[model samples]
Target: MEGTRYLDSEFRFNSGRLSLDLAATVRRRASTPIDVLGNPNACGRWLKAAGLFSDVPELSAENEEALIRLREAIWKLVTGAMETRYPEDATAVVNAAARFPLGTPQLQSRSGTVSVVSDDPFATAMSTIARDAIELVSGSLRLRLKTCDQPDCRMLFVDTSPSGQRRWCSMQRCGSRAKGHAFRQRHELSVRA
Candidate 1:
């Protein structure tokens, strides 16, 4: 439901990339300029200030760098999607912060309204970790991900199954129709035989 806004038939084959999409959705949702590369600093800072990263120095530094790259990749994908550009993937984004988990050790806020007085390093770390998690989900579900075999209906979807043999984004929609037509052809052949 949250991602219903962006997940269309055009991106149906990306059901495995839903986790990545979710983060994109959130980033876009919180975004102001609306441009793909509007203001990475402002957006990145906002996420960090919002308690999304960790306060540790070494970990936060690594995450910050990864987050910047991830944002750049995401922006490229968004621009590509809008311009009908395909082939670009989300692997870079997923693997960037994949080394570290986002939310570890439950953090608490004892002060007034949980504000990081000095430079909020933790928030930055958390943001990248969040992006990494989405990437992991994308990788895990990549096998099930499918681009509709139909030339016309090239939608994407997660082919959740034991056999990993799903052929269409929706059988009731495209699969059933293809089957019906095939059955009719077979019946006609039988009669001719």
Candidate 2:
């Protein structure tokens, strides 16, 4: 969530309509609205809407068992951005995304036996962005990015700040909180003296 600010609005459709949809899904991590969709939840919805798993009825069966796993994998990838050890392998990344509400994902079998494989179905949907997330955490990926320092806010944002010293997710929201706190502290100190 904290790294989403690094994304570009123009990128929503940059690679075309589908890519734009994915970008929009990824960008939801930065929104603070009542319907703010987190990375995990959005990933699930995207997979179904994108019809990536339609061929396998079991994949979308019984309350979206497969979708849940996919969402968890995505969450891990986003949360891992703040960690010292970025996931090096696809398994690690997939595991991270599968942390949300998940279940046994039954993949279609060529032999007529649906089975769950370590290879996450959602990972295929995420293949487009996993490398970018890894590169970002490893410092190999660079963009005009910044993280909001607001204690209650974990949103990531693009630094459109003129000085690029912006620390809050948005000056209109988190910025006011920081300023109000600083003002209170200054008043308390003056009163003590």
Candidate 3:
């Protein structure tokens, strides 16, 4: 609600994986964290911007609470998976979230071609995210999950690069800041010498 800054374009869809993106809804996980999902409206907007829903759904306060719970569960599960350990209650939470109804794939004809489209935006968004979390933790992609190396920014991401050596949430954001900080420190040290 108050921290609308997180809903800005800069914070949307940078993570290569949707589940990682969801985990990143909270900024600065290590310190001075900001909860981006400050309200149900914010959560609905995030879902829409994430492309999980074509339009923002009307979420109740209970839905907001459930989403926040799921978000924390996802974060714990992912971080634990990275360390080859499962966080206590993480599996149960994820399994419970997965039990939510999922979107039904409906075949529709558009321009004389039939294509499957997802119905029920709310269910689809939640179910897809839950499934993604399960897959990431239980599949080979678990090895690719990483937390940002930026000191104050501990966002999560999937290393999609060919080298799998990515360290920042975004090159233009955290990477540039880190590079500039290193350059300034070097300059200061040379001056002192």
Candidate 4:
């Protein structure tokens, strides 16, 4: 699927990690959140977009619920970890989900196109995401984990820039808006001055 398809869907993979990206499937967690993964087809699209599946894998209700459970746990764990703590319940969920094996990629046909061959795509994807969350919460990257500073946006992203000073989810998205708003406010104040 085209990467730009995110503009048409509720999914955004810009969170900088598979696990955080999954957590972001539910937008605006602190406010009236939106569940973009509303159905099996949507979940499949997410898995495919995340590169966990080469195609839209058939998702079962049970697996979908499990996926949501893992996503929620990862969100809680990451947020709590930011405060130098990890919730015991969320940690347990992540630990259990991480036990599942990740999807295995295999070459297909003479085209040699590679695809994840998994008997249970949900389990495999969950494992991959859970492992990512585990690393983000416990490894050096935790120091770089940051939430967007935009007032209306609270997104968790890793500061992968060399200077490690990224503060917004996307400079084009939130930074530009905030800058313009600030500029407008300054102009108004200067007018009064």
Please, what are the lDDT tens digits per residue for candidate 1 over residues 89-111? 54445444444443434335664
Clashing pairs in 4: none
Each model's TM-score, in the order given?
0.36, 0.41, 0.87, 0.88
User: Candidate 4, residues 18-112: lDDT per residue as tens digits?
Assistant: 99999888876666777888754787788878888757778778878888899889989999998889999999999999998777778878998
Taking all chains together, the TM-score of candidate 4 against the true structure is 0.88
Give the range of the ten consecutive residues with the poorest summed lDDT in model 3: 111-120
Please write out the lDDT profile of model 2 over residues 25-131, one tens digit for every residue: 33334455322134334434445455444432223343344334333443444345544444445337454543533225575657675643435555554443444
**Cα lDDT, all candidates:** 0.46, 0.46, 0.80, 0.85
- By the TM-score metric, which is better: model 2 or model 3? 3
Show where candidate 3 strays beyond 4 Å: 1-10, 111-120
Q: Pick the candidate with the highest lDDT.
A: 4
**Model 3 RMSD vs true structure:** 3.5
What lDDT tens digits, residue by residue, belong to model 3 across residues 73-110?
A: 99999999999998879778788778767765555556
Worst 10 residues of 4 by lDDT: 1-10
